[model samples]
Target: LLGRVDDVMLVSGHNISTTEVESALVSHPAVAEAAVVGAADQTTGQAIVAFVILRGTATESEDLVADLRNHVGATLGPIAKPKRIMAVAELPKTR
Candidate 1:
């Protein structure tokens, strides 16, 4: 049997799940894939950082990032919203 603990991040005393943040990101029409991680933050303890693979119609720009951040905020909540969003060509894969 194989098992492990759920990867949960603490932000301002709140439990934020990376999977939840990633799901919120992909829900945006412009996003193809997303990976969410926790970054050390002086105020929040940890902040949500997202790396996104955008759709063909999407471009990496300030407006797009703001839109994505707003999308996540609407989908989830302000707390679940990504503090930083980066568009990436691809995410590393392992077989």
Candidate 2:
């Protein structure tokens, strides 16, 4: 379903869905939740950027960033891996 939508981003000519990236990010043990957005890029057209909330015990660091990237890469391939991953205290929500 995500693969067929106009909301899907074209990254280096590859279709990338924000839903798929979020799913991949949360699959990592350290991640509790994830939100993904597409950022404009001259080379890739759009780049995947991820904001993540980590589990209580997980510490945010460069090593963790690399690990999460590797985790998503393993699950969704290199193309689906986030170009930027940032740990956030919370994701704003609207009811």
Candidate 3:
């Protein structure tokens, strides 16, 4: 039986912490902040996706975005890496 502490899955397998992705993003100078989500994926059981808002005059460039994704791979290994990242203007805070 599962207890209150039952684990959750995000992308690569089961029982992943959101902090891994968070730590990856916060390491970048271009990123102001980021929010991650575990969306359903038909192929992998789950998919890790990220929404980012840029910092001080940073343009929304693809290379920087790619670097951020690669940074995740470096920080948390390929398993904890995000499959997709979207740069957003603002976050949906209360929903």
Candidate 4:
């Protein structure tokens, strides 16, 4: 697997890798990079939340968010789609 064991998330009894979701997000032309996490959810056990950095030519918008979600769903699967996707200026990194 591309990701470590710890990166696996249990969502609705399905095992999902954060890297897989990240890959799906980055597949879109507008997305430069992506980070995904599993958040506690009463219904699905865990919901996927994504933080994405857009390409310089792209802008953040509600329409873009919807499009990204749909793109993920189509690229991966509906179950793999993120519950929420937030646009961020940059991702935290260690020196």
* lDDT to native, each model: 0.87, 0.89, 0.77, 0.93
Tens digits of lDDT, candidate 2, 1-95? 23536458889999888888889898888999999888999989999999999997998899999999888889989988888999999998869
Write model 3 residue lDDT over 3-91, tens digit each, in one string. Answer: 33313455545566665576679788888888887788898888888898988888777788789888888887878777888888987
Q: Which candidate is the best by lDDT?
A: 4
TM-score of each: 0.90, 0.89, 0.79, 0.91
Encode model 1's per-residue lDDT on 5-95: one tens digit a residue.
4457898898988888889899889999999888999999998899999998789999999999998888878888888999999998758
Between candidates 1 and 2, the lDDT winner: 2
lDDT of 4: 0.93
How far in Å is the alpha carbon of 4 misplaced in model 1? Answer: 5.0
* Clash pairs detected, candidate 1: none
- Could you give me the TM-score of model 1 versus the true structure? 0.90
C-alpha lDDT of candidate 2 relative to the true structure: 0.89
Error (Å) of candidate 2 at residue 55 is 0.4
Runs in model 1 deviating more than 4 A are: 1-6
Deviation of model 1 at 58, angstroms: 0.8
